[model samples]
Target: MNYTLHQLHIFVKITQTKSITKASEELHLTQPAVSIQLKNFQDQFEIPLTEVIGRQLYVTDFGREIAIAAEKILAEVHAINYKTQAYKGQLSGKLKLSVVSTGKYVIPYFLSDFLKKHQSIELILDVTNKTKVIESMEKNEVDFAFVSVLPEKLQVEGIELMPNKLYLIGSEKIDNNLNESPNSILEELPIIYREEGSGTRYTMEKFISLHQLNVKKKMELTSNEAVKQAVVAGLGYSIMPLIGIKNELLNGELVIIPVKGFPLSSIWNLIWLKNKGFSPVATAFLAHVKQEKTKIINEKFGWYLDYIAK
Candidate 1:
């Protein structure tokens, strides 16, 4: 019944990664050393913990239970360690955050000052599609998540940061004035769309449905950059956030199509699970964002503000 925390940690990592080699790599231990520890751990329990099949490691049912218990123990240990540092008035830890793809353009700008101010904090930012970001958030894989569309079912604590404005963009070579009406554009122009599960695509669909607009979708692209490029090549038009294409808009490479009920607006939000506790670093970043969002947006996103105003 006596097992070291180090042994338990290695066991948990092995179970999660399903590879002793990977666990060793992550733990910065030699492969043979990890194998010895794992063997010793199994001997203490006198229970087969893992089975090898097709050259891949798989944890048994008993191993799964032990792994879950080990994870909880490790989490408590980590909390104690963090509390010790906090008591010493030291704020030093890694902050893990995930954001929707479009957030890459906006989140960094908001985080820059905070990162510079808190030199002790290490930031791990995962920029991915909306679906993956939401999945990560729901699984509590990240400390914070930035999204334009809020998940209705998750019990979350969130703050609205800024407006995300979506506009129909086309190449400057085309006459944007001609397709001011949805019906005219529906019949005459081809529309480029983002891939499924995109926040932009979701918002665009809602807008289309609300207005009873049926447009011809010419292509479905995986990324905002791809959609923008397709539109710039005169292949079709796309609805994208203004934040992502400020430079193109300013340079006149793309023109916003003046369509009715245009510039579909949504809110940017920072969220975390309601029951999850926030570390000091997370709390600090939350405060920084809450205080600086408006000022930063007005300063860095002045073009968007001005455009929306007009």
Candidate 2:
């Protein structure tokens, strides 16, 4: 459709979300408003943009070309915004960031301190699952990502951010039943697992495989929060990043197992597309990460730093 940059943005967002309803919610627009815009666009175009089939909306092949063009056009707009602001000697733009589910356990804390220090710069965070995190980064929807056990195939250049340990955690409901600590529960406890593509799940499974265990699973969960809740409900035990349970463990809402083959740790990565250029704000954020990396770790998790302390 022959449309302005703003309409192209709405069009691209709707295409990505695949539902007018979802796109409306994300854009803070009324569903009818999006509908009206789509109608207006169709009237101006040489061909139809979307077709409805069985309660689902599909962009036509012709519409796909328009969507792709819109994406590139929006990206150029964002690029110009970056250039315009950088010309003004200000790192004052929103840094759109996406992080995997587990990464939130620690990122918010770090990001808060960084944002407080850089008051003019904004951090727009999109906390999502691992697969979405990688896809969003690859699509240039996000400026930076902190992910765990990221696939090596991602066309992104990543730096090792930090190493994180996994632990067996369960709800406080099982605290009394825990005959031993999580580190010691690997022998016979039924374990709640993350879904198949989960990096955390893969890492945990690899640890069990390394120890040569039978690899029995109790249940599979999709979210870390759900796993925590399930363990709290005594539905089953689950292995999660140490940071995920730190607060709960301290609050006595969940307990760590003293199982023998635990403390399964893996490296966390800070990744960005190798060919993508960073905005001034993104560049500054990365610089902060590099400069304060050590002190941040020392203050954030003294227990983790103990590994290096020794």
Candidate 3:
């Protein structure tokens, strides 16, 4: 019943992706290499870990159970490696963060300096949607979650990092008629949207409903980038975080529609459960944010301050 850590890691990835080919690509191994390892690992156990049904791969019930255990083992191994680094007097551990898709632009700026200072600290930043980010926080899978809007159901403590301003943006090729009333523009143009569970979608819907603006929903995309691309391609307009579209705006690919009661704002917050305990790395990161948020914003987001001033 002896298995190497490599086998456990490969098996865990297989269970996650449910495809040997996908697992190989993720792990940077050849398909034959992954297959050989999978066969070797499977040979060590009597019960089947994975099964193939037609062309699709599926993890069996036992495989799911084993994957959970394998994840735990892998986590411990990571902890051990980090602990070894700590013994050398470096503040080292895994700093796991789940950030909403648009937050990818924001969080990395906040992290850049902190990571440079602490070279041994391992950063696992999961850039995902709001629903998945909240799910990770609920499952205690991350040290922190970066979001513009806080979840009503999760009682969490957070530090505000910066302002997240959302604007109704359209392709620059579209008519820039500032004379039109907000409601008239909304009613006339089709609107693209982030999928239902996105924070941007929530804020957009709230703004629409609060203003009671009659609008047409043209399409629903899952990510901020996708929505931005759609808007840039003149598919439709969308309420998007200003941070996510800076380059496009600068290059004249996209333009913000100046609507009354527009640029809906929220604070980008790094949040954790109210009662969650932090590891040394997480604690250091929190402290770093508290001390450097203002400086980071001033350096990285001065344009936003200028935009707000106007």
Which candidate has the highest lDDT of all? 3
lDDT of 3 at 165: 88
> Candidate 1 versus the native: TM-score?
0.73
lDDT of 2: 0.77
lDDT of 3: 0.89
TM-score to native of every candidate shown:
0.73, 0.77, 0.91
C-alpha RMSD of each candidate structure in angstroms: 4.9, 4.3, 2.3
Q: Sort by TM-score, best first.
A: 3, 2, 1
lDDT of 1 by residue, 123-213 (tens): 8899888898889988988999999999878888888988899987888644546436676665577889888988999999998887787
Please give, for residues 3-43, the per-residue lDDT of candidate 3 as tens digits.
Answer: 88999999999998889999999999999999998899999
Candidate 2 per-residue lDDT, tens place, 86-181, comes to 677755678888888888876775677778866667578988777778778877898888888765677777778678788777664433344443
Backbone clashes, each candidate:
0, 15, 0
Off by over 4 Å in 1: 1-88, 176-180
In model 3, the runs with Cα more than 4 Å from the true position are 1-3, 45-47, 60-69, 173-180
Selected candidate, larger lDDT, 1 vs 3: 3
Supply candidate 1's per-residue lDDT for 9.
Answer: 90
